[model samples]
Target: MRLLIFLIIVVPAAEISVLLLSGKTIGFIPTISFIILTGVIGAWLAKRQGLQAIKRVQEQISYGEPPGDALLDGLCVLAGGIFLLAPGFITDFTGFFLLIPAGRNIVKPLLLKIIRKMIDRNQITIYR
Candidate 1:
């Protein structure tokens, strides 16, 4: 909870500062163009990854297996896309990592570990 609150406030503030500094150094037009390009690319990747997730889920269902973490993966992708859509280099960089397959693979395990710990601590509950 504390971490979430800190991230919510600090990340955006940091991003804004970085964006302002970069804009001042590189000029506004280039900075805007970079932000827009990232947004467009992120959107395309998000759509493609979303479709892939759906397909994987369908395949699992057909095989009598649950989709399980696929839903979590989809949510991460969505969050990453939203982060990328936000206008800032820090957010865009973080979003890119989340969107990338290799990055997703690395982050997923860490996230699952944290989630498991939270569940074990009774900080979070899983409902069927």
Candidate 2:
């Protein structure tokens, strides 16, 4: 709830500030071009990573192993791609970060922790 509120308020403000500064520094056309370029690049990277993760999941399944890590990777890539689709510098940066392997590894544990907390609080339930 707090995170949702913070993002709703802060992300737009930060994006606007960054966009205004970029426009002033590099001119309007260049700023817009840069944003578009980042979006395209982020999308490409996310697709590549998502495919790789899916492949890993398939491999794990073939080996009769759980694909938990690969599944998380796919989720992260999906989120990164979604973020990239949004037209904002802050989101673009976040999208690129999430699309990267090292960044995904860094965030995976945090994401798992949050999920565990949600399960503990009955906000989420898992059935097997």
Candidate 3:
């Protein structure tokens, strides 16, 4: 799709621009150090959040309830962890936003809507 192509090209270009600007503004060593620090912290946060999501899923299963929401949370955390591990300031920020509960809440409905749309369009298939 055009949007995917735009993102694939634009996002990396933007990320590189920001990274170069950061290095020039803050000095290369400090910029790299900050990036490393954020990656470490983000990984830790993602792990903790992922564990909590797993617990929630288990609890829901024990109650004979569907684990959809918990599963979505796990997905967000997984994506966040991956983004954090990537070398870019924009991705690190997005990774943190996805990993944090408050921010995740802001995104969940949007994600759910997208999933529903995909399912409706037969773009995604779920097997029971």
Candidate 4:
């Protein structure tokens, strides 16, 4: 709850400050153009990555294997796409990082650790 609140308040505040600074440093038109370009690129990357993830999931399913990793890839792609779509430089950077396979790999262990912690703490419950 506290983290959620902090993110909701701090993230926008930071984004706004960064946007203003970038606009001042690079001018409004360039900043807007960069944001638009990132959004377009992110959309394309997301679609491509998403399709690949789907293919992987389908293949895994066909082989009687769980698509857990593929689904996680899809989730990362989805999150990246969303962050890139938002009009903020920081988010665009983060989105780009998450969109790439290497970047997703970097984040995966951390994400798994958090999920494990949550499950251990009874903050998350899974049914099979």
Candidate 5:
């Protein structure tokens, strides 16, 4: 809750400041264009990665193995896509990070740790 509150206040302020600074340095048109460009690239990357994850999940299921990792990858890609769609430098950077395989791999352990904590706290329940 505290983290959420902090993000709600700090993220917008930071984004606005960054956008203003970039606009001042690069001009308004270029700044807007850059944001749009990132969004377009992120959407394309997200779709490609999401399809690959689905393929991996299908392959694992066909082999009678759990698709846990693939599912997690898909979730990350989905979240990245969402973040990319939002208009802000911070979100775009984070979105691209999650969209990239290496970046996702780097963050996966942390995400898994958080999820485990949630489960332990009974905040989340897995049915199957």
Candidate 6:
């Protein structure tokens, strides 16, 4: 909750400051165009990655194997898509990484390790 509040307040202010500086240096039209281009490219990459992840998950299900990492990849792709839709370079760069298969694989293990530790410590609970 606190993180969310900090992100909501800080991210926009930071983005606006960066945008202003970029606009001044590169001109407003070019800055806006760059943002739009990043968004379009990010969306395209996200869609491609999302479909691949889904297909992999389906294959795992059919093989009676767990799709643990695939699920995480799908989540990263979704987050990337959302971030891309938001107007900011920092978010877009992070989003681009999330949309990449290699990046997803790298992040998945770290996330799983953290999750496992939390579960072991009983720090997280599922209602269902």
Per-prediction TM-score to the true structure, in the order listed: 0.87, 0.93, 0.93, 0.92, 0.93, 0.90
Error of 2 at 97 (Å): 0.4
lDDT of 1 by residue, 11-41 (tens): 8899989989988999999999988998899
Clashing pairs in 5: none
Candidate 4 — which pairs collide? none
Report lDDT per candidate.
0.86, 0.92, 0.93, 0.91, 0.94, 0.90
Candidate 3 residue lDDT tens string, 1-128: 99999768987898899999999999999999999999889988999999999999999999999999999999999989988988889999999999999989998999999999999999999998
128 in model 1: Cα distance from truth in Å? 6.0
In Å, residue 3's CA in model 2 sits off its true spot by 2.0
Backbone clashes counted, model 1: 0
Error of 5 at 65 (Å): 0.9
Off by over 4 Å in 4: none
- Per-residue alpha-carbon lDDT of candidate 2 for residues 36-106, written as tens digits (9 for 90 to 100): 89987887898899999999999999999989899999999999999999898889988998999999999
RMSD (Å) per prediction:
1.8, 1.2, 1.3, 1.3, 1.2, 2.0
Instruction: Please report, as a residue range, the 10-residue window in candidate 4 with the lowest summed lDDT.
Output: 107-116
Q: Write the per-residue lDDT of candidate 6 for residues 12-128, one digit (tens) a residue.
A: 898899899999999999999999999999988988999999999999999999888788889989988998988978888889988988788888888899888998899998553
Per-candidate total of colliding backbone pairs:
0, 0, 0, 0, 0, 0
Candidate 2 vs 3: which has more lDDT: 3
Q: Judged by lDDT relative to the true structure, which candidate is superior, 2 or 4?
A: 2
Clashing residue pairs, candidate 2? none
Looking at model 5, residue 49 earns an lDDT score of: 99
